[model samples]
Target: MTNSENLLEIRDLKVYFEVKGGILKRTVGHVKAVDGVNLSIKRGEILGLVGESGCGKTTVGRALLRLIPATEGTVYFNNQNIFKLKPSELKPLRSQMQLVFQDPYSSLDPRSRVGDIVGEGLRVHGVSNRGERHQRVLEALRMVGLQEHHMRRFPHEFSGGQRQRIGIARALVLNPSFIVCDEPVSALDVSIQSQVLNLLKDLQQTLDLTLLFIAHDMSVVEHLCNRVAVMYLGKIVEVADREELFRNPQHPYTQALMSAIPIADPKIKRQRIILQGDPPSPLNPPPGCRFHTRCQEVIDICSQVIPEQIDLGNQHFCACHRRQPVQEAATS
Candidate 1:
């Protein structure tokens, strides 16, 4: 059973990409890619990070695993500060934290056999000998619904869904406690997407894995995640339990995102929120709330001061200056 306690705790994590420019070739400014993101994921829980393109959803996931180093703040994985670990100390931890890349076609090595590709992690981590690694690779492939005979083939030989299965097998071979699935199903056909999603869900339950599933699809998040975070620009504007946020979204940006999701019932129509203007450049994000430029319910205070995340009853959180506590809003 999941401990219901924090498996990963991230506080004020900031990841900035430096942009060198100007006539003198100086570092003029930085792209505030992931600014002060605070979140915690419990053991075996899947936290869905959803947002539009360039919203830093992928950066947050990558930073947590130190694929890209954070500019500031702390990342605690199972109570150990991940940033503090030396190169040698981190080698073993690499096996525990794995990543499933978005593009299956390009992720695997063309020269390597499917079996060798999956077993590479086992070999790197010194988990077993060559014979044992081969066995583990076949087992991982089977877990993802692929036959052992297919292990001899190359990544090019499989369909998109099968390639994704290979990617999943690669991650699972390490027996990771945590996996960052960055838009895992985005490249596949709609039909294949569901198959991959179901496979992930089944694997999560069976392996007791913790996941940070990043995607732009709200429906995908709704189906797979227990809690959802909405990101805009470079900041997380709202986060809450999946059901509660969908039922009562306090942030205007989040509401806009929810409106875009197609409802199954034809009678239950939702007004699509179309925002004017493109998202601000990460090199220079807008002052105060990054979402203020496009928010429908903007106020003067939103432009002057950055809103702190407020708990709006039942664990729902929103970072909007105009937001009232859920109880207060209900009473009024």
Candidate 2:
């Protein structure tokens, strides 16, 4: 796709944390949290980043917002390289790109009133006038199906769903173009999860917002996202349109993940592909294809060489030796 079509682009994104050892606290190794991830989010579409826990899905989201420093890579927001910008230059852009955190309980300050929490961004970005900030906060809360009075109370007074709505309001109050929703509904009850998801869907449509929705649930991704990217051990294994990926998952990892999604109909039995072994530690990940150890479809090349992301028509891409063309695989 053209650069003009995308609101955000991440190229070769890698975030590694230093692992200290010994009394001197010297660097022993690195935890490759997000390694060589490349993806793009369109102007008004939700792209789901799905993987098991510790797969670096959250790191990618934080890196996009520059919440944590990246070891290497470039992130272009509106064609501007965010990593190249100075602190002063980046500060203003923060309002345009916001994050809705996973846990509402911890994300919100207990001591602060809802109004202050939601309007904190406005205050930081120079909405100095209290009346204006209050009005904006009220408008945001209303959009999330919350009343004006709810803002006067503290976070402790609200239910789990309301607190999440408040968190969403905090992100929305800034009138952001792009939002990194870091599993906004994961902590809530199943019923509450649907409510929060619906609210997000409605808000995205109403506000024309682009979202990088990070989640482990395939069913939720299928419901909310326009496109999906499957991440495995800090690398994206596959990317495709929502319908296409759900209908025909190419990578073995992607197929295994898709198999775990519970089908509602009891009559229609689906075979479950249970992945063997645990995920390799990020501190010392296995060579070549990270999923090769657990993947049932074993090939000699998979253990020896990294697979290139191969295009499979209709905007679908898979990074798997098995998915490569027979002639291309033979040549390699």
Candidate 1: residue pairs that collide: none
| Model 2 agreement with the true structure over 71-170: per-residue lDDT tens digits | 9999999999999999999999999999999999999999999999999999999999989999999999999999988988999999999999999999
TM-score of each: 0.95, 0.97
Model 1 alpha-carbon drift over 4 Å, by segment: 1-4, 263-265, 326-332
**Cα lDDT listed for each candidate:** 0.91, 0.94
The alpha-carbon root-mean-square deviation between model 1 and the true structure, to one decimal in Å, is 2.8
Candidate 2 lDDT score relative to the true structure: 0.94
Error of 1 at 102 (Å): 0.6
In candidate 1, what are the lDDT values of residues 1-332, reduced to their tens digit? 22339899888999999888988888888999899999989898899999999999999999989889999999889888899999899888989999999999999999999988998888788866778888899899999999989989998999999999999999999899999999999999999999999999999999999999999999999999999999988888899999998888889988888887777789987788977788899988889988889888888988879999987888888899987766666656
Off by over 4 Å in 2: 325-332
